[model samples]
Target: MNMSWKGVMPAMTTKFTDDDRLDLKMFEVNLKAQMKAGVDALILGGSLGEASTLLEEEKSVLTRAAVDMVDGKIPIVVNIAEQATKAAMNAAETAEQDGASGLMILPPMRYKADDRETVTYFQEIAKSTSLPIMIYNNPVDYKIHVTLEMFEELLKYDNIQAVKESTRDTTNITRLINRFGDRLKILGGVDTLALECLVMGADGWVAGLVCAFPEETVAIYRLVKAGRIDEAAAIFRWFLPLLELDINPKLVQNIKLAEVATGIGTENVRAPRLPLAGEERAQVLSIIENGMKTRPKLPDYLNL
Candidate 1:
């Protein structure tokens, strides 16, 4: 399947059993819900999907399950975040074999590679896989920014085709468009910045809050792209509070809590990561509850 990479793609959270195993059943439930809500694609095992904690074999299962569940309704892309060049290549190969439609790759994990090293790392992985790649460029969290010059170097590779732009510098979105134009598809990576990025011509959004509110997320994207800026802004104003949850350091727990509150999944996460608790938990729940109580009604066109 050829994915346009020009609309909403949820950076889905990995659903876990109460005892911390991959819950394929509930995962299918969530994927189906996103599809029913009109999401354009599904990206699994991203930072939002808890990729760092997941085992290699678990990623395979998740990839294959997503391919099966989506069944070509939308493209399923797997995220590869590894420390070694060879390991990243192997993961990319594995994702392709597992039937993933594409791959979202971060630079070498842990060690901050210089621009030369980052270019080489991405080049090596892109050479190894037939899957289309979306370079994950968030210097804030990943510590290695894929600068414009580095992207200029990377643009030589045909498959290094997209970017998950989360530099927190919205200006960089316009810069990317000015520099790369049609060569690279830009997907807004920060939930809080999705509206601004889209307004500034980001091709799509790799959204986190969509896990909890798929329809609203899709509605915002559609309305914005359709030139209904005022309608989109109204929903975005209401969404900003919940969307802020996606940028927190504890985003996985925060988003999962919202998922549980919204009745799509659970707040259960693996060890080293626990469910939200105490005052933080209360505060998060209050935000979600308040948003739910005063949710905006979908426009008549979107109601379809």
Candidate 2:
């Protein structure tokens, strides 16, 4: 599938079994739900997907699975988070070979690279593959900020086409537009600010909570694009509490629990990371349960 790099593209969580093996069964179930809800692409092994815990070969396996499963119906994008430029490049090349339609790459992990080193890192990875790249720009969490000036330097690479805008600042979307016009696509990376970013003319959303509430997430994008602000805002208001779950530090476990509640996924995560428990689990369940009870009846936005 050709990646348009637009619309709702989920940063999906990697599902695991009781023994921590890849739960491709549940993973495919979530993929079908995302496609059925009208997402444009699937991003695998992201921060939400627990990229750090996954082995390189495991990522390739997931990529291959998604590519074969989607079978050109939608693009499958693999996330690349490595400490070295060579490793990141290798991951990019491997993803391309494994049939990934695109890549979402974070800055050099563990060690924060300077402006020049960071640009070099992305530039080398861009040169390593023919796949389109979406730079994961989340300085708020990642520490290393890919500034607009750095972007100007990166514009030299044609394959570096878009940004997963998770800086937590909505103005960055407008700044990207004002500066680059249509040269670079901006996909909202933060779930809570997704609607605002779309309304501000962002081309897409790299969403988190969509794993559990695909319909609600896609509805906001479709309604906003269709110029139905009032309708979109109504759903957004109802979805705000659930959306907040994506912004927390334990977002992976939180959203997985949501998936369990929605009957679409399991709550098993890899070691070092466990399922939500005690009062924390109860609080998150309360939010998910309440949201499910009040789940809005979505319009046929796909037809629009």
Cα TM-score per model:
0.98, 0.99
Candidate 1 wrong stretches, greater than 4 Å: 300-304
Task: Provide the RMSD of all predictions against the true structure, rounded to 1 decimal.
Answer: 1.1, 0.7
Backbone clash total, candidate 2: 0
Q: Residue 125, candidate 2: how far off, in angstroms?
A: 0.6
lDDT of each: 0.91, 0.93
Candidate 2, run of 10 with poorest lDDT = 1-10
Residues 208-243, model 2: lDDT tens digits: 989999999999999999999999999999999999
What residue pairs clash in candidate 2, if any at all? none
Best by TM-score: 2
Please write out the lDDT profile of model 1 over residues 1-304, one tens digit for every residue.
7868789999999999988899998898888889988999999998888888999899999989889888888999989899999999999889989999898999999898999999999999999988899999989988998999999899899999999999999999899999989899999999999999999999999999999999999999999988998899999999999999987889999999889878898888987999999999999999999999998898753554
What total of clashing residue pairs does each candidate reach? 0, 0
